[model samples]
Target: MKIARREAWTGRVLLLVLMAATLMPFLSLLVTALHPSGSYPLGLEWPDDPQWGNFATAFTAARMTELLKSSVLIVLGVVPISLVVATMAGFAIGHLRIPGRRFVFLAFALGLTLPFEGIITPLYYLVRDMGVLNTRWAIILPLIGLFMPFSVFWMRAHFVNMPEELSESARIDGAGTWQLFWRVHVPLAAPATSSLAILLFLWTWNQFLLAIVLVDDPLQRTMSGALGAFQGQWGTDIPLLCAGSLLILTPTLTVFLIFQRRFVTALLQGSLKG
Candidate 1:
């Protein structure tokens, strides 16, 4: 009993420490953002007179409305297509056991190690040759491809662990390949797919390196990507910069908070099955 109590206390303490570590930076940013523009505030000091209008100023100056639209469009373009392709590939490899599936899975596994920075230079030239540089397609297309390996791996993990009895029963129902996947498996995979969609949405929305490198126009870049331009113009104004940074970060935070339950559920489901 004493040992169990000690372990419980240890876990609680660790969780509290981790929670503080995660939230401290955000707290500091909020505190710093409330300071008067062009006035340097050290650390997490609360201002005597907080400048709440800084957020509005940052929003107007950064043209956040347009950035929001661009981000939405880019996410819409990337996430759905990625989910579809990754799910299909995973189904084939995990459920169907298509010919040469081992080799195909190996290829995707190798692709998982290919770092984004390593491919950027070659990607630049390829996009330039294709004449899609400086456009949304440049960001959209590459992100879909870049995301595939991990996405497919995630889905494959879920599908491979699913009971073979389910597939056998579906086949006994005279269901063809498409019907079996669509009717039987897809519904059961909702938690997995929804969680995957949330992650893809976050990744696509926050894609900065690709957005900055491929798209020159600040207006065309993802919200995080536009941080480069926003910082360039206002780097010296610490408070405004922090405000803009928070503005850019809000959507992602909101998304994660709203769907965190589903995400946690999916993760637990996978772990339990595994």
Candidate 2:
């Protein structure tokens, strides 16, 4: 009992330390955001007057409303396309007994290794040639392609681990392949789908590089890209920059916080039961 008590105390101490380490940067950013503009006031004392209006200033300068709308539209477009394509590809690879299935699976999985940097130059030319450059579709289309590999790989593993009996039974009931996939396998693959959706949403939402390279017009850019423009305009204003960063981070954080319970439950169920 004494040893167990000691172990529990040690665990609590470790958790406290970890929490502080994780929170310190965010705390520092908040402190900086509240600090008065011009210069850090002399002495280490907290600001006598915190500049909370920096947030509003950042919002207005960044044109956050329009940027957010662009981001939302991109995410909405990318998530469904990525999920659908990845699901179909994963399901086929997992269940369909096609010739050279393993080779095809490997080919798709190789996409995970192809870094965006290597492809961006070529992709830019391709988009330009296709006359889609600077359009929202340019960003959305590439994102769907780039994110599909991991999604397919994850969903394929989940589907493969699922009971073959379930699918076999559906086939025995005279369900067509499409019906079995859509009505049966897809429904049972909910946990994997949910997990993938959360991941894709986060990825697509926070995507910066693609947004920067593909989008030229500030009006068409995302929150992150808009923040870059904001920085260019107000680089010296650390408070405003931090405020913009916080605003940019809000959607992804809110999403995870809201769906976190479901995400955790789904992940555990898919991993352990499927």
Candidate 3:
């Protein structure tokens, strides 16, 4: 009993320390943002008079409305196509065990090792040649392709671990391949799929490097990508910069909070299956 109590206390203390570590930066940012715009307050100093309007100023100056629209357009283009392609590929490779599955899966596994930064230069020339350099498609297309290795791998993990008994029963009932996948397995894969969607959403939304590099137009870049331009123009205005950052971070944070339960459930399910 004493050992168990000591271990429990240790866990609690560790969790508290981790939680503080995670939150401290955000707290610092918020405090800094509340200071007067253009004033560089020392770390974690609270202003005598908080500047709440800095958010509005940052929003207007950065043209967040347009950035939000572009982000939505890019995400819409990327996420659905990624989900469909990754799911189908996963199903074919994992559950169906198609000929050359090993080679194909190995190909995707290799893709996982290829970092985006390493490919960005070639990707830039490719997009430039395709005449989509400044368009939202620049960001959207590369993101879908960049995401495939991990996305397919994630869905494959779920499908591969699914019980073969389910497939056998569906086949016995005269279900075709399409029907078996759509009717029998897809529904059962909801938790995994939803969690994957959330992750894709967050990744696409927070994507900065690809967004800034591929698309030249700041208006067409993701919100986080636009931060580069925003900083260039207002970098000296520390409070306003922080305010804009908080604004950019808000949607992703809201999404994680809303789907946190589903996300946790999917992780637990995957761990159990593994």
| TM-score, per-candidate, Cα-based | 0.98, 0.92, 0.98
For model 1, the run of ten residues with the poorest summed lDDT: 161-170
Q: How close is candidate 2 to the true structure, as a TM-score?
A: 0.92
Error of 1 at 61 (Å): 0.5
Stretches of candidate 2 off by over 4 Å are 41-45, 270-274
The candidate with the higher lDDT, 2 or 3, is: 3
lDDT of 3 at 159: 96
The CA lDDT at 39 in model 1 is 95
lDDT of 2 at 21: 94
Candidate 2 has an lDDT of: 0.83
lDDT of each: 0.94, 0.83, 0.94
Candidate whose lDDT is highest: 1
Spell out the clash pairs found in candidate 1. none
Candidate 1 lDDT by residue in tens digits, 187-260 = 98899999999999999998999999999999998999999999999999999999999999999999999999
Report the C-alpha displacement of residue 101, candidate 3, in angstroms: 0.3
Task: Provide the clashing-pair count of each candidate structure.
Answer: 0, 0, 0
Give the Å error, residue 271, model 3: 1.1
Query: Of the candidates numbered 1 and 3, which has the greater lDDT value?
Result: 1
